[model samples]
Target: MKILSAFLMLLLPALVFGAEQTLVLDVSGHCGSCKKRIEKTVKAVDGTSSADWNKRTKKLTVSFDDEKTNKDAIVNAVLKVGHDADGKTADNEAYSNLPDCCQYRDE
Candidate 1:
């Protein structure tokens, strides 16, 4: 019984401190400023641990705590900041409002 109790104690932390989830999603933008914007937008979401945007790949890789936020939430946040994510496009007004240098697709 004592041995079983010790094993459960060792396993408890793992259950409580769940592993961080990593998700990579397509995000559209151009230039260094775009990279900064996308990453910053994702990181602003509650529970997001980190965000990386690749200019060449146009992929946004984010690490976040699933318990507090999900992929959809992160994607929406990115969209709100005027970036395209997955199949969701940014709000037209917001997209159009981005600085000329940050625009990825022509209007």
Candidate 2:
């Protein structure tokens, strides 16, 4: 039992550390202000290590600790801030409320 417990302990860190992931989500945005808003929203989420958006690619790449927050939570954060995430859409009111220069699509 002691040997099994030791073995499990050794593997626990590996399992936990391996949960950190960097993912790119298709996020819609138009310009620099959009970039700032998108990145800020992602970084506000707990466990996010870094967040960046590319205006050309319209992709938001985020690195986060999965133990603290998952992809869906991150995506939802972006959506709440008026950007369309990979599998989620921004609320109509929120999207419409964004600055005109930040709108990426015509609604």
Candidate 3:
């Protein structure tokens, strides 16, 4: 019984801490400022652990805690900051507010 109890205790932490999820999603933008903005917005989400945006690939790779947030929440946050992610478009006003050089629409 004691051995079983110890084994369960060891396993509990793994289960509780393994809710980290990683996703790579298509993100639209056109410059270094865009990269900074996308990554900063994603990292600001409640449970996001990290964010990386690649200028060449237009992909944002992020790691977040699923228990406190989800992909949709992160994507919405990105959209709010004027970047489109995972097939969702940013609000018109938000997109319009982005710097001229950061706009990807004309390209």
* Best by the lDDT measure: 3
Against the true structure, candidate 2 has what lDDT? 0.90
Per residue, candidate 3 scores C-alpha lDDT tens digits across 24-76 of 99999999999989988899899999999999999999998888899899999
lDDT of 2 by residue, 13-64 (tens): 9876747799999999899999999999899999999999999998889999
lDDT of 1 by residue, 1-107 (tens): 99999999999987997578999999999999999888888889999999999999988899988888999999999888888899898999989888899988774
Ranking by lDDT: 3, 2, 1
On the 0 to 100 scale, the lDDT of residue 61 in model 2 is 92
Clashing pairs in 1: none
Clashing pairs in 2: none
| TM-score pick, better of 2 and 3 | 3
Indicate the worst ten consecutive residues by lDDT in candidate 3.
11-20
lDDT of 2 at 66: 82
2 or 3, greater by lDDT: 3
Off by over 4 Å in 1: 1-3
CA deviation > 4 Å runs, candidate 3: 1-3
